[model samples]
Every structure is written in C-alpha cells, then in structure tokens.
Target: MPRTGEGTTVRITIGRLAEITGVPASAIRFWERHGLLPVPERRSGQRRYPPEAADRITVLRTCQQAGLTLNEIRELQEERPRRAAMIRAKIAEIEERRTALTRAQELMAHALKCSEPDIVNCPKFREEMTGWRPASD
Candidate 1:
C-alpha cells in the first residue's frame, strides 16, 4: 500500500485493493477485462492501482447490487454528471426494497406467532395480504 499525502498519489497493489475493497482478485481482473475498470499499471510484472481506484471498485460493487449491468455502469462512469443521478436513483430503489423486506419480515414474524398450524389459514396473515388479489381469481 502506498500512502498518499496532500500532494502525493498512492499506488496500491492488487492484493491490497482486494483486501481493502473486499473484492476478489479474480473478479477485479474480470472487471478490468470487461471494461468496467481501467487496467492497472504493472510494475515488475505486478499489477498496481491508484488509491482512488479502490473506491471506484467499491462503487462498482454498489452499482452491481443496484441492478446496473457492467456495461451500463461503465457508461454511467463515463458520464460524470449522470453518475450521481444514477446512484441516487439506485439508492431510492434500494430503500424501497428495504422497506418492503421489513414489512415482509414483520408479516412472517406475525405468521410464526399465530396459533394456527397452517399459516395460510391465519387471520393475521390474511389481513396482511388483503390488497393482493390472486390473478387467477
């Protein structure tokens, strides 16, 4: 790991980037191959990346979780202004999913506490599912 000061740039090794970013070296190489990240410079046949590159890799992982394809994320990265907007949209989508998951968890907890052996027959479960009518019905 190369330390950066106010005016200095840091050079991080592939292993260090993987350790800091929690991304495997193989995946990092794959990302580079797919054009998601620029190829790192090689020193004595060892790959090295700038410190900022690790943060970029972390952002790429977040984008992947937010349903963006690698190509789409690469395009987003190319457009600086749109990158923030895309990230914001993804954050909102993730929040909505989190809220839905919380509600689902609460319903599951309630179902588990019900006295009925069959959760499908529980009144609380029925109440929780009120608005979702079966399409086949």
Candidate 2:
C-alpha cells in the first residue's frame, strides 16, 4: 500500500505517475522542466506527486495529439488572458489544413476515375485545376 502524504491523500513516485499516465519518466521530466507540470514534493530526495498529476499529463497528451506544439501547449496552458486568441489561431490553422487535405482528396479521386493516359495532359484534369495555385502562390 502506498503511503499517504498531507492528510489521507496518497503521494505517488515519478515512476508510478508515469505508469499511471502511460508517459515515460523522461517525458514527465521534460514536461516538468518545460513548466507544463508543477514541481513535485520531494520526499528524501525522491519526487512525489499528487494523483492529479496523472490527469494533468492526460490533458497534455491530448493537446499534443491535437497537433499543438509543446511551446504552444505551454502558452495555451499558462496564458489565460490570451487563451481565447490562441485557441482561435489554432482553430484557423486546423481549418486551413483541412481545406488543403480536402483539395488533395478531390484531385486524387478525379485521377482514380479518369481514363487519361497522362493526367497532366488530360483536358478534364487541366480544367479541374482551373483556380488551383501552387503552394508557393
């Protein structure tokens, strides 16, 4: 049984926190260094975290999976005044990516059904590219 620290709350070691959150200890340390996770209480030179650390790590993983960079995540977590603006910016980025992917999908779908020997020379393909511009444009 794990020992309780500060009343009946159980304090978990770093290894246990990683296991509970499915995050590596190295990553946990990295997050701690990056200010994503709060500094843990030290017990005899060993780090001990409250159980809520697992929940915080879960949120961090979820934000990362959503394509947020670590710096962006840190900003999102720490910047309360600009949080709404940051979220709006992220939403715009996602929408832009979605539009680009959808355009690519449309091109691929047309290519699959076209009977043209060379897609580039196909009149229909060229017509389909009417308003399309290079990424650099």
Candidate 3:
C-alpha cells in the first residue's frame, strides 16, 4: 500500500490527479497559481490534494467539455446551485446537438445508398428538404 499522509489525508498525488482528471499537471499547477484550485497541502515538498479536490477537478473538466469558458466556469463554481443548473443545461444542449447530428448522418447515408440517378431529385430527399424555407423573407 502506498503511504498516505498523516494528519492531512492525501487522497491523490499531483501526477495521479492529472492522470485521472485528464488534465496536465502543468495545467493543474496553473490553476492552482490562478486560485482556481485551493492550495493543496504539501508533504515532503510535493503537493497533495484531498479527495474533495478530485471532485472539484471533475467538475472543472465537465465545464470545459460543455464549452463553458474558463472564466464562466470559475464564476459558476463560485455559486453551487448555479453551477449545477449550468451543467444540466449544457448536458441538454449536448444531447440535442448529438440527436441532430445523428439524424443528419442517417439522411446522408440514405442519400449515398439511394438508387436514384440524381439524389437531388429523389422523392425522399425532396420530402426532407421541402420544409426548409428562406427565413430572411
């Protein structure tokens, strides 16, 4: 078993945290320098984070994946309820975009395998494009 810190519970090492969070150690160090992550306790000149810090880093990664800017994420993190709501909204947006992309892929696949000499003139393609009208009118 790897030695755990005494008095100060070291849940993860800097390298382990980086590996699990998919964030570079340098980035984590930068975040610490910027006051994004609380200053972790040092043991033998090496920084170690508590278990809760892992959760925080996960939330940070989630915000990043959701397209939230770093500043926006930082602000959101300052408020718990708002951060949860923002994450929920981001998840919904991602799902909606994924559904749209899947539909587009299906349509394109159908078009590619279509037996029609001209896919543009295919009835199915025509039906799919029928509802599209210029919104600028």
Candidate 4:
C-alpha cells in the first residue's frame, strides 16, 4: 500500500521496474534471494515492487560500480552489529587500491613519453626496474 509521487498508491511489476532501472529482473531476484533486497508482494502470482525498491537497486548498482563485492554491499546495507567496522575496513582497502592504481597510471604515462625504444634501458627507468622479471617465461 505504498504511494508513488502522484498521490496515489501504485506497484510496478518486476519487468517494468527492471526496464525503468536498467537492472535485470534476474539480478533483482538474485539480490532478494541473497537478502540484499526486500521480498516483494505477489499479486496474481507475479512479483510487484514498491517505488523504494528502485532507489535500493540504484544504490546497489552504484556500490558495485565502486568496486564493492556483493558481501561488502550487503554488509553496508544491513542493520548489522559490525557495520561501522566493516565500512572502515572497506574504505581502507579501497584507498590502498586507489593509491596503487594511481602509481601504475603514472608509470604508464612516463613510459609512453620516454624517448628510449625500450624503457627498461633508460637510466631513470633502469634503477626502478630493479629485479623486475619479464612476464613471459
């Protein structure tokens, strides 16, 4: 009995919601199955979702796009005992990865600009390439 923006109560079918939100129906069902989503009421044996479910799916997709695993997103979404601790841990992990990726990008940029045919042969790069092994065996 949830009211949408039109001052009237409304419910959308799973397929319609999926098309509106760009989330697959199967993924919505999977999230519900895995406890990430609330179970919807069935009208005429078809799932019907409230408007709030769209916002929840948006947040879930955003979290996944930001590199959070399903378990991590679930931890953040749930009313759990250790939510804060888990959030802190995930933030730390993401920060570490961001720092590493930044370094890698900078290295690639430098390599691309270097005039040397083989970057490893350059004096500046040679010092940094110490003990680096070739990827191919």
Candidate 5:
C-alpha cells in the first residue's frame, strides 16, 4: 500500500486490496476478467487499485449473498438501461423461492405432529399434497 499527499491519490497493490476486501486474489482477478472490476493501474508490474476497489468488492459480495448471479451483478454494475427489469426479475425469483420454502416448512411442521407410521400414508399429509401447487404454477 502506498499513499501520496493526504490520501488524495492513494493506491494499494492487489494483495492489499484483497486484504481489505476479504476476497481472494484469484477471485478478484476472475472478476476483472468478467468485467466486474475495472482494470487497475499497474505500478512496477504490480496491479495497484484505488481505495474505492474495496467498496466495489463489498458490493459484489453483498449482491452474491442476496442471490444475484455474477452476470446479474455485472449488469447492475454497468448500469444498463434494463437494470430495473433485471431487479424486477430477481425479485420475482426470490418470491418464488420464498413460497417454496414456506410450503416446505408447513410440511415439516405437520410431520412433527403426524402419528402415522409413514408421513406419506397420513391422511392429513395426503390431503395437503393433493392441494399443493408449485409456486411457478
């Protein structure tokens, strides 16, 4: 890491960038290949990133945790005209996943109270399955 004059033009090597971002160097390079991170300036053959790269990596990590694919993250980063559409699509996907998870929870809860030797043979469980519809439908 190197700083020049009151942090107005500070730069850090790739290793330092990874240290601050908690991302592996290989992963950072991968993102650069995929256009997720802008190519950094090279100082004496070593990649030197501005302090802001850490913030960009944080955003990438956050988006990944929120279930956005790398391509989706790239689209968001590029600020394409279809950004809103992509977000809406992701929201719909999350809603469907939530619905499926809720249904699974209900089934598990019922299983705990079920007295039948086999849950599949339980009358209540059978009725529930008959009425069950996938979220996509």
Candidate 6:
C-alpha cells in the first residue's frame, strides 16, 4: 500500500487503491465498468486513481450495504434532475423492507417459544400471524 501524502497529488494503481480502501481489484474494475467509479488516469499499462477514489469507494460500499442495487447506485450517480424523487422512493422501499423484516423476526422469535411441535398447527401462532395461510392447509 502506498503511503498517503500530505496534500500532495499522489495517484496510485488499482491494486494499491484496493489495498488502501479494503476493496478488491475486481470490484473496483466492476464498479468502473458500471460507471460507479470514474475512469482514472492510466499510466503505461496500469490504471492509477487519485486519492479521492477511496472516498468514492467508501460511498459505494455504504450504499451497497444499505441495500441499494448496482442500478440504483448508478441511477444515483447519474443525476437527471429527478434524483430527489427517486431517492425518496428508494427510502420508502427500504423502510418497507425493514418493516417486513422486523415482523418476520418477531414471528420467528415467537415461534421458538411456541408449545406446539408443528408451529403451523398452533392456533396461537395462527392467531398471531393472521392473513397468512400455509399452502397445504
């Protein structure tokens, strides 16, 4: 890994960028192909990215961990004057998914304490999980 300089314009190769950012070279290349990362200046046969590339990679990693798809990240990167609305919709979607997951977790936790050997056969579980029915039933 190349040592970061003090306010100097130091560019590093893709592998070095990966080492600094803890991202894999393949992922960096893939992001470049997907327009997530701006194409860096090339020297000889190596791709050299500016220090700012690390920040971009951090943002990408964050968005991905927050459940944004590659296309969604690309959409965010390429602002077409409608990004705010799109972002609000995505937030709404993430919120909905988070809510559903919470409910699923609660249901599973309750199921663990259920006395019935077959949870689906438990009336209490059925009562708690109203509006859902087993396909076999």
- For TM-score, the strongest prediction is 4
CA deviation > 4 Å runs, candidate 6:
1-8, 131-137
Where is model 1 poorest over a 10-residue stretch in terms of lDDT?
128-137
TM-score of each: 0.74, 0.71, 0.65, 0.78, 0.74, 0.77
Q: Which ten residues in a row have the lowest lDDT in candidate 2?
A: 1-10
Per-residue accuracy of model 5 over 79-136 as CA lDDT, tens digit each: 6899989999989998888978888998899999999888999998888887775566
Clashing pairs in 5: none
Encode model 6's per-residue lDDT on 16-134: one tens digit a residue: 99999999999999999988999988889899898889999999999998888998888888857787777899899889889788779978898889888888799887886775444
Worst 10 residues of 6 by lDDT: 1-10
Who is ahead in lDDT, 1 or 6? Answer: 6
How many steric overlaps are in each model, in order? Answer: 0, 0, 0, 0, 0, 0
Counting only residues 3 or more apart in sequence or on different chains, how many pairs clash (N, Cα, C under 3 Å) in candidate 1?
0
lDDT of each: 0.83, 0.87, 0.78, 0.86, 0.90, 0.86
Per-residue accuracy of model 2 over 33-134 as CA lDDT, tens digit each: 999999998999999998888989999999898789988898888848888888899899988888788879988898899899888887887986775765
TM-score ranking of the models: 4, 6, 5, 1, 2, 3
Model 1: how far residue 52 lies from native, Å: 1.0
After best superposition, candidate 1 residue 85: deviation in angstroms?
8.8
* Whole-model lDDT, model 3: 0.78
Question: What's the lDDT for candidate 1?
Answer: 0.83
Better of 3 and 4 by TM-score: 4
Model 3 misplaced stretches (Cα beyond 4 Å) = 1-7, 80-96, 116-121, 131-137
Better of 2 and 5 by lDDT: 5
The 10-residue segment of model 4 with minimum total lDDT is 128-137
Error of 3 at 52 (Å): 2.4
Residue 37's C-alpha lDDT in candidate 1? Answer: 88
